[model samples]
Target: MVSVRDDATMREALTAGQSGALADAYDLYAAAVYGIAVRITNDHGAAEDVTQEVFVELWQRPERYDPGQAPLRGWLCMIARRRAIDWRRRQVTRDRYTLLLAGQALPAPNVEEDVEASTMAKLVRAAVHDLPPLYREAIALAYFYGLTYREVAVQLGIPEGTAKYRLRTGLRRIGDSMSSVRAE
Candidate 1:
């Protein structure tokens, strides 16, 4: 468990609105956050954006963090997952909408399929988003970005088992989310 003093230090740094403190925090966690983002998007640009967004969010809404519940690392990872998932959802929605508007009906999506695809995608994204950053990133790299688990581990600087664990957990979460969406 992280000591109270450590948590207090972080909270104080954040609450004081110290820009340098935020930088210190970022330096402490940027690699992990960037690894998570890169694992998800598989694009350097997107990962960088996600990294920046995560720190910016921390700066903007430090109150959302509760040291009592999770350590600082976990909190940052959670935020990183959320931002990556949101980015994917928005990207998918925009692309799909653009394609549809362009009069390219590749498939006849019945109301159910259409709604299910979009809504389930959103829910699945959210579920994946809520996962621990490591797991979320592993799953994103393997399934979403078509990378091998070995590649994921290499990219994230984690062991192969860890990468596989994240992939499994992420897939389970996505499956659960899909089922929930279908039931709705």
Candidate 2:
């Protein structure tokens, strides 16, 4: 067992790439790092992840630590705290995205409502079909085909004012038909 008496010795041993020094460093500072992580994150699982990440970072980049700047315990605690806070931020962002996606998702279909709406649409289509040929053509061109009034006029070879008048008259006739059906 390598005896890590002080931070300087630990640094020297770590710089020399001794695995025993890493074990010794972990033994000395793991509890303090974990404590800081738990305090910051307030979650046991997240704290454990943060603790593991701190040690992995230390093992991967031993040269990053300078004993002249700070003690090993303080450095490890700082890393743990930062990792914990970052984990919390990531969790918050993930939860927000989940909620946003849920809000935007399509709702399940209602059988009765779907049936009623489909029946009403069929009735309206029948009424439109019963309209006079001139009005039926204009309404189908402007509404069903999503054409503007000017486009409908151009397509049907009629004046724009004539197209508008046909559309209005056609809609009124459909409304009257639907009203009569409802009354019966």
Candidate 3:
């Protein structure tokens, strides 16, 4: 086992593709990373996920950390913090949408209205499923996931304009499909 005190040597070993260095780094930093993630996320499961993500990122891209810029622990903590916050943001968005969908006021509790709503929802889901992969992803992220176009762009790693375009185009196709379904 490498000495945990020698971060520079550990980083060097990691950069040189040494697997033992990664295990040593995890031993030295996992608790600190998990602590930061739990503090930010307030969820043990999410904190564990964030901690795992931080370590996996470090393993995949060891060069992203410059020991000259920051200590390894600090770098790992920062990554954990960011991942935890992102996880929290996604959770908030999901909860908000779930509540919004659940709390929608029904139309006087009529059987006809309920049937229509169910049918429409099924049609929309079918249309969404029929969309191209990129369009479907954009629509799902923007509408179903309650993300703004910019957020969808960031999540999809696309430009904001592209996200907007895909969303617009996708919704138009879904609308057209619904129109045809209604006509039939």
Candidate 4:
């Protein structure tokens, strides 16, 4: 297994396309990458894809590594996080207006208030319940499920943009509703 600290050497090996070095790196960091991806994406398959993409990207852009700054793992994980976020954001954009254009009404919400928490939790749950279906899905997947936008998109089979949009709109709506509930 390769030591993650010797990023300078790793960068050199990667730039030279040394398969052994890459394999060593994979052996050293695959678990770390997968753990982070799984935490961010909350889906095994999507996390696996993100993990694969990170390595592929590292190989394609080996020169991007800078030993003067963070370690190789840091750079790799950053790329994974960004890619995952981008994936979900694209999904959000694609699905944003689809149902509206179809002239279909928003589905009835099935959110249940959490009785265990305080009134704020209950109100928050109520607000989430009132959100549109897509928004609710996005919010739940992103927050409750601990998934990045990319993983959410993969799980939902939607564009990343659409997933992002849902999260944004859902949060805004929930905030507004919760404020109103609190004010009353």
Candidate 5:
């Protein structure tokens, strides 16, 4: 909802390729973008990198943003969120690969037990990740965020019973998935 007059200077900077304009935009919007990154990444260093990446992209591809389409801060926050999510995914994959290598390099004393434990952990993670979005959101709020059912309902703007139901259903699905692994 930025009026043309409000964004005239920014539009000019983006079009004319003015350095100071980019700097001014960075100073104004960097903190908001960084806050979103930190919320998602939960790592200040990664958030900092994400924030820097956002501004660099803005500077490099100013034409990608349309002031008429959305506010600059909102567009930047959306980009920050996607980047932070991508970073977290890459980190998870890297960590898993590193662990695999380390496991091969140093075998545990009880190979059977270690393998079983690792397999169960993977199964549990997969079960949670594969949950439908509705149940997954409730599970994340109630369990990961440590919100009580009532608090989760309030956070998600749903009734308490609905929140509890989602949590129960999600956990039941996970348990069903894990039951086979337990038997094995």
Candidate 6:
């Protein structure tokens, strides 16, 4: 067993895949990584996920960590920060898509709330709910669950081409409804 105080030895053991090195690293660094993730993501669940990803990356690609460029702790923290930011961004996108399709008002990022935009949001939500079950299921699978087209197809027992078509046609119908509203 390498001395835990010697980070260099621990890293060398880690690169060599020696047993206990990873555990030592987790003992020394997991708390710091988890702390950074929680601060950036503002969610404990997301923070735990991010922490796991960071450790996995470290274990899978220890060579990526250049001890000369930065310390092991610094590299781990950097990875955690980036992962937490990505997690937060995905959540924001999911929330935005969910709001638009779940009968909620759209949130303007930097501009004042426009009444016209709000009305269009309602129109889109109504159009989505009015869609036939086939298209509605496709939308829910893709947007609500964040599944890829292939995954959606697999989940719904449909061909990938059919899933793509349903997503496109469903969106097109919503567009058509909005277009008609604007025309009137």
Q: Find the candidate with the highest lDDT and give its number.
A: 3
Q: Backbone clashes per model, in order? A: 0, 0, 0, 20, 0, 0
Per-residue C-alpha lDDT of model 2 across residues 1-184, encoded as one tens digit per residue: 4443367788778888888888988887788788878887889988988989998888888889987765576677778878988988898778777877889654455899989999899989999999999999888766554456776787678999999999999999999999998899
Tens-place lDDT per residue, model 5, 104-138, is 54334688898988987899889999999999888
Error of 5 at 177 (Å): 29
lDDT of 5 at 4: 24
Error of 3 at 30 (Å): 0.5
The whole-model lDDT of each prediction reads 0.76, 0.81, 0.83, 0.75, 0.79, 0.81
lDDT of 4 by residue, 107-170 (tens): 5544554433566787888898888888887787666545678766765789999888778889
Global lDDT of model 6: 0.81
TM-scores for every predicted model:
0.55, 0.53, 0.55, 0.52, 0.54, 0.57
Ranking by TM-score: 6, 1, 3, 5, 2, 4
Candidate 6 lowest-lDDT run of ten = 1-10
Cα displacement (Å) at residue 22, model 6: 0.4
Which regions of candidate 3 fall more than 4 Å away from where they truly are? 104-184
lDDT of 3 at 1: 70
Which clashing pairs does model 3 show?
A: none
lDDT of 4: 0.75
Candidate 6 Cα deviation (angstroms), residue 119: 33
- Report the candidate with higher lDDT, 2 versus 4: 2
**Best model number under TM-score:** 6
